[model samples]
Target: MPKIDVLAPRSAYDIECETLIIGAGACGMVAALSAHQQGEQVLVVEADAVPSGSTALSAGLIPAAGTSIQRAAGINDSAELFARDIQAKAQGENDQALVDQIATDAAEVIDWLAQAHGLPFSVVSNFDYPGHSRRRMHGLPTRSGAELIDALRARCEALEIDIICERRAFALFHEAGEVTGVAVSTPDNTQETIKCARLILACNGFGGNRELVGQHMPEIKYGLWFGHDGNKGEAILWADKIGAQVTHLGAYQGHGNVAHPHGILITWAVITEGGFQVNKDGRRFWNEAQGYSEAARAVLSQPDGEAFAIFDERIAGIARQFEDFKKAEAVGAIKSSNTLEDLAEQLGLPAQALRETHADLPLGETDGFGRTFGDVPLSAPYVGVRVTGALFHTQGGLKTDTSGRVLKTSGQAFRTLFAGGGAACGVSGSNDSGYLSGNGLLSAMVLGRNAGKA
Candidate 1:
């Protein structure tokens, strides 16, 4: 079984640095690059050979207002509007300070990445994601997270920052309650102590830990986890050991339509563009417009943990803009048929119920599930994929201030300790319901930058 690397050290080799970062995912990579740009000596360590985490698994949709791209696209958005959307979606349960800080710093960060680091980000105005009133999302041309990660890795390489992989960080070295460094174990089981003036935890959350998931977020115990196994809640564990206050342990991001067996995500753009979901009985169960993450529970509650995503050719063409959806089509993950009955037969569903659902969709008639029909009507060449719910990543961990300073229960900051990405409490509220689109990457990038700067 694949498991997170957690080891006990019996020996130590002394190494020193000005800043030490753990986990080379988007957060750690960005933090290292930002700190290095600021003329600070930095080092990064990763448990995996390469940095493949939730960031790489994501669709790379980053929501930020007031960006140069957004302004060029003629969008009238600002940090206050973004912060309002976040608080409203989170039901006012998240840390407003952190939310405001990220919103305010979002444009600067994106601009810096584009100008200073040569990252290509453009405004996405064609479609809207959940909880956002504007088209402020920006990403690469292909909108691929792998591309985003590759870009960050390239910048890190150019900066000549050393990223030691396959090394597990198990313990923190502290001096009188202030973290000074970390204890890392090599592939050969050799242990070393790397002392530093500052330490940032970007290792991410505990989604891979079955016990931790069961203890904190039991509702998702049966869902599929489609994130990196290296995220073992090392930051949470380490922080808790030192009296750091943790929050939103029940919060997580989930997806309602991950193509089964193919292991590729079916983009929610299909649903927003007039696609629909049905349970095993071939009947619409809920409004798919609720967004993928929020609608995950409905799909998870279906019998045998199975559901089918149904869309027409028009929506398929629109969704093909996403690389994963196109790949799903190429691998025979998406099944297509010329008629509703044929599609239902292929899905092993009742032909009559499926036909009736498609027929009534364009008539503006309300079904038992109350799904409002859009202008696009289902016709010949129906497209679909067998899908299941997935637990993407935990959105909660160590609670920190707006500046990424990890705090204690008494609200005191750890002088030399900071955290970002999955290692820190995300902007999502106390459960899975508060995850707005791009919350994970937003928290990761903004908080990572703050930690590096501070």
Candidate 2:
């Protein structure tokens, strides 16, 4: 039911701009900034009063190779290795050319944000994500998506770029296969049409649309939708009406560790730092190191659709860098105990099964799931959080060329149409398991930069 209305072009408009961007999230903001840098009159519109989308709900880290932040942190990484990591994780299911382009352009995008926009970015060298070979994640001081969005919004403000919030674009107007303008409505149901030479769709994916999720990704249809509510498949709907080529409709990003009832995101650092997850029965289910995106189905399949993330104080210390983790702690979502037995009792898990599960952690060899435990094991005092699986956002949308130009089914580019972020087919291939850490922002910012440059 939430679809973009396609209409014919009108002679006049309420506003005009050289380039118009839909959605004020990371992708849209980046595109607006990039276009502004090229002396293009850019205007950004958002459905909400402020720019808070899926990016704000994330950890706000973007993976980039060969960045100054990485060099300053003494990390040796390159675009080729990053591309290989993506391809390996996706099992070569994604487009190699697009992967390479995104990988190569990533560092430039990071550097540009810091030097040009004055966004303080630093490489997250504390630990490596699942598929990445090196530590290349870059984030702001808070290491939160909200901080990233605020910084981008501030940069837009400093540049005098107009960002009109609370204006939802509901209709797209085109003439002779070229996008001409869009129809937007305000909170009071007042309508306005804006004409633009070029249009970029950065409105994100359809994870919030229950019907679209049931149609494309029924696997997580019943799971919690943890993304922005405005992501209702408008970009995909517009693309469909315009006959744009779409691919990887089933690709999405899922998480297995949203704090139950509190609804806060628990960073994967707990698991990566030697913590483990157990079902309500206090039995370890699968290899958590396989990556968080695939863990959604694993966690959801358990009894009662819930699990407990078990970790120690040292791991919790590392996780404290995330604002979400701190919020979860403040809200009492995290429970701490001095011993495994006490922790099991607090979580209502079977003490004996939890002890056996903890004892099975291999120190030398790989476990059944091929995850190797380090010499340092979880010790007292122990910490645990009740968590459930959630659908973060969809990873697939309109198929585009390397430059972020939306293409028709016949492989021809639309003269004035572009897409980025969740509106574009991502590099995650065709499934949740293919998602690497920071892949969502990678597509969002890089493709957004491309669209703006175009």
Q: Which residue pairs come into collision in candidate 1?
A: none
List of clashing residue pairs for candidate 2: none
Residue 155 local lDDT, model 2: 91
What candidate 2 gets wrong by more than 4 Å, as runs, is 1-3
TM-score of each: 0.95, 0.98
What C-alpha lDDT, on a 0 to 100 scale, does residue 94 get in candidate 2? 94
| Candidate 1 wrongly placed segments (more than 4 Å) | 1-13, 362-371
Tens-digit lDDT track for model 2 on 347-389?
8899999999999899766899878887888899999999999
lDDT values for all models: 0.86, 0.93
lDDT of 2: 0.93
The top-ranked prediction according to lDDT is 2
